[model samples]
Target: MNEFLAAGLVTALVAGFLGGGHCIGMCGGIVSALTFALPPSRRHPARIASLMLMYNLGRISSYTLAGTLVGGLGQLLVSNLQEVARILSWLAVIMLILMACYLGRWWQGLIRVEALGQHLWRYLEPLGRRLMPVTHPGQALLIGLIWGWLPCGLVYSMLILALSSGSALQGALLLLVFGLGTLPTLLLTGALARQVTSFFRQPLWRQASALLLLAFAFWQAMPLLGFARELPF
Candidate 1:
């Protein structure tokens, strides 16, 4: 990938990592439901891991699909490469700032943005509900497929970033990488799940993650600010 694409991918990755808190808040109940829904006999580590893996893969696939659609739209609407680059650059920084606000719970204005998605989510949610008590990995996977459309500001932010990519393939890759970045946090299960989720949920941790993202937002804006995108050190 070119540096532009590389940077966007990296940004997506970091955003996903930082979104661990949001993920838990958004999907923790569903995850817990899936866990408890399992038969006691199937609660072994190996089984849980497989189920979570399948579910996440399904979720990531949905994200990739959204990226492809949005990126294609961007391509059709924008006919200039330089224009795409500018859009990508500006959007990366803007999304980062918004993300920082989200991570810290400083501003919930993003919740308003979720309204745009609620219409689609209502249609998808029932399908997911039907898959409840995920008795099998397949059920978990199916539920994930449907739940991926859950109205989430973080996911939507990443979609906006994907919109700036202006290439369907790159947009898909961006979301794919983002999904991977979230894997570490979302994969948490058993005792580790509580410990890690608790850590990410703490005010200190959230604030720290938000601050880091803010620094990153400024770093992304360096070029636009008339400074070298890469400091010579």
Candidate 2:
């Protein structure tokens, strides 16, 4: 991969990791519910691990699919209107900054942004419910595919970054890495929800993560503004 694509993927991963606190609050309940839905006999430690793995695979696949579509749109803009691509990149930087603010609790505006997806989610949620009390990993996978569409500000913020990606492949890769980054927190939550939540909830950690993301946003913005500098990969 080229330097720009490499950096984009790295930034996407960091954003997902740093946004763990938010993800916990947004999806923790659903994860817990899914875990409990497994039949008792299938709730063994190894079995639970398998189920969680399938669910996340399904969720991340959805993210990759979304990224592909948005990235294709971005590719079209870049092909036809280079200036528009630049403008969208700047907008993506702004969205990243806003994401940092939301992560740090400095502002809640992104919550309003999440409203954009609610209408679609309303339709998908019942289908997800139908797959509940999942007996097989396949069923869990299907449910997770649906659950990935649940509206969240963090996900939307990342989508903006995906859109800024110049090609469909890069956009899909960016989100794929992002989904992998989120896997740790979400996968572990079933076994260590309290501890993981407490760690991410600490003010020091949250602020530090927010600052890191903000710095990344600035780095991305600088290149767009003709202030490019070598970034350690």
Candidate 3:
């Protein structure tokens, strides 16, 4: 596998698990609203599950759109091998550091970077609000697409990983996978937020996940450091 691809996949899974803590803070109410939007006649377990799945589908679609855009951008930088890989490797290192910060409780400042996406999100906001009083699964799904534009540091980090992919399809898939990874927590916000949040807060788990991410970052950068290079499968 490409080192960049590996890093991106790892990022998606980690972000999915850890990134959700922030979702509960920012989007918990959205999840609740989505649930309530379901028809009371079929408010049983299956209907709720369907709504959750649709929300995730919409969210993942947004990630895919983002990945395609960034991945295409990456190709523009591909002509200079050393330069492009150097930047990408550095990006991986930065991602590791940010992950460490989130885990170590030392630097909460990373969240502020999400503001960079707020400009685009501002445009999407009105559309999302229009979908309010979500009465059908399709409306809920559309709302998720708009909601996917929500400013989030974790999503941005994953976007960086996608940009590092060096190919449009790969980059898009990377983001899609990352978005899918977060599905469990985001989908369950109404039911499992408390439990998942508590468990994720464990110091040991956070630290371990951080270290794992740091190691992956180092590995991804190894090619630029002369430690490795792309090899045939």
Task: List TM-score per model, in order.
Answer: 0.91, 0.95, 0.85
Compared with the true structure, the alpha-carbon lDDT of candidate 3 equals: 0.73
Q: How many backbone clashes can be found in candidate 1?
A: 0
TM-score of 3: 0.85
Clashing pairs in 2: none
Query: Residue-wise lDDT of candidate 2 within 29-91, one digit each (tens)?
Result: 877876787678767888778778888889999989988889889999889997888888888
Expressed as tens digits, the lDDT of each residue in 1-233 for candidate 1 is 57556777777898889888998888777777766777888788778777787788788889889989987776765665556657765876787788899889898788888788989988999888887778788988888888778898888878877787778887888888888888888888422768877888799989988998788778777767888665322
Please name the candidate that would achieve the greatest TM-score relative to the true structure: 2
lDDT (Cα, tens digit) per residue for candidate 3, span 110-141: 77787888889899989988888776678778
Q: What is the lDDT of candidate 1?
A: 0.80
Error of 2 at 87 (Å): 0.4
* Residue 79 lDDT, candidate 2, scale 0-100: 93
- Report every candidate's CA lDDT: 0.80, 0.86, 0.73
* Predicted structure 2: lDDT: 0.86
Q: How close is candidate 1 to the true structure, as a TM-score?
A: 0.91
Better of 2 and 3 by lDDT: 2
